[model samples]
Target: MPREGLEVENLHLWRGEHHVLRGVGFALPRGGCLHVTGPNGAGKTSLLRAACGLLYPESGRLLWDGRDVHEDLPTFHSVLMYIGHEAPLKADLSARENLRYWIGTRRRIGRDTLGAALQRVGATAWSERPARTLSAGQRRRVALAALSLLLVPLWLLDEPTTNLDAEGQQLVGTLIEEHLARGGLVLAATHHELPLPRSRVQRLELTHE
Candidate 1:
């Protein structure tokens, strides 16, 4: 059997009396993709946030690579990337500049590859345009381009397909497949279907009573 990717046990969260997740437990297998789905306020994003260490759980445990995440946040974080609902980009920077900044400072994937990543996301046309001047979809492409700079093993994405056209969606799908092929794990909260073949996907539905 393959190594366990991530694990959550009895995960419970609260926002001042509003219970988000309730006793959630699951294991993300290496090279697998888990799709988390739910109505708004069902805590899909909350769960992803907890797994990524952005939010602490009220009660429970989270482990990455079979080790407690909080025990070694540095190592755990090095192998994980989290993309939230809002696109994390700087308005003053051009698309290429943004990619180079992330690659050079955060990911260390080499600034020279920034151009290739932008081209792969079809944002090469405006790679030199400031992020604020680009359309929403165009901006999203630039943000997604940063993913190409990551060489980690786990990805946690929330609504990653938003603002993407059909072809752009297909592009991201292909990247997901490539990541899985390289033994990476994906835990994504998406409201849309992915355009990939032979994927191992687990759907999680959340409900509040």
Candidate 2:
């Protein structure tokens, strides 16, 4: 077996003294993908949050490339991108402006790549429209476009296909495939089935007792 790209050992999490996750553990190799599926309140979001260092685990370990992710958050974050259920775009800014601002804030990509990213997401039509004026699907595209400009290896997405139309869904599916082909890893939590290779994916379910 190859070394795991991401791992969680005996992970446990809680919310206000209520246990949410119970000793959940799994490992994915480099270039692997995992789809976490479960009913609402099954700790799916909590698990992703904990793994990405956004939430602290009550007990357990999260390792990236065999090293403790919490030990050096900066380095770990550099290799990872976490997109949560809520869109992180600024509603006041235009689609293009949002991407431009994020890129400038992170300085992750060059100025020249901005237009290309917007074009990739099919946001060229309304790139100049304020995010508030755009539909939910359009906003999500902007967020995805931001991710494309970065060079991260691990992508943790939550309901990434939500609010997307058929074409948008296919677009996202293609993006994931491309990511995996590049030896990158993806751990996504979705409520709907995604059109992707099931052989290279594993399903994990979280439920309450």
Candidate 3:
């Protein structure tokens, strides 16, 4: 059997003169969840970005399934799905249109599948509204719908519950639980604690460096 998971080792990063991350490290296997916790300016987002190869760390190794991610980034990206703080929808595009355009490029998605995803996230009411016209919570729901449609094995989420209400936050927890049940991996940076079991959740707390 092979080592199946994502590993970040002795990671370090710098933004100008400030040392944002210092020796941050962790390893998460299939069905594993890593909660990256830290206050503002502690580099939680930077760690997630670096793990997904969006920002190269000054010094670190990111391994996916025992192989260096840098060896074949495209292959790694194919299995990874990243959802940042901001919903990546085009402002002028309708919510459905934005999802359609985004998902069409990555994989084949059917109308029924898309509708179900939107409905799952409680975004069906505004599914046809322009993204710019949607509220923050609505936009976040749209993003969650996109996440459902992507169906990748690994999720790198930054503040997934941003702008969501109590019910919306619970919905996110359900989505994560379902994803994890399917042997998916999740690395989330959030101020709000996820509603997951302690046995399945791993924590890495960073402080000002």
Give per-model TM-scores. Answer: 0.94, 0.95, 0.97
Top-lDDT candidate index: 3
Candidate 2 structure lDDT:
0.86
Question: Model 3: per-residue lDDT, tens digit, 56-127?
Answer: 889989999999999999999999999999989998999999999998899998999999988889888889
Candidate 1 C-alpha lDDT tens digits along 9-104: 899999788988999888888888888877888898999989988889989999887788989887888889888887777899987887787657
lDDT tens digits, residue span 22-55, model 2: 9999997778889999898888899999989999
Least well predicted 10-residue stretch by lDDT in candidate 2: 103-112
Candidate 2 ranges with C-alpha deviation above 4 Å: 1-4
The 0-to-1 C-alpha lDDT of every candidate, in the order given, reads 0.83, 0.86, 0.91
- Error of model 3, residue 32, in angstroms: 0.4
Superior by lDDT: candidate 1 or candidate 2: 2
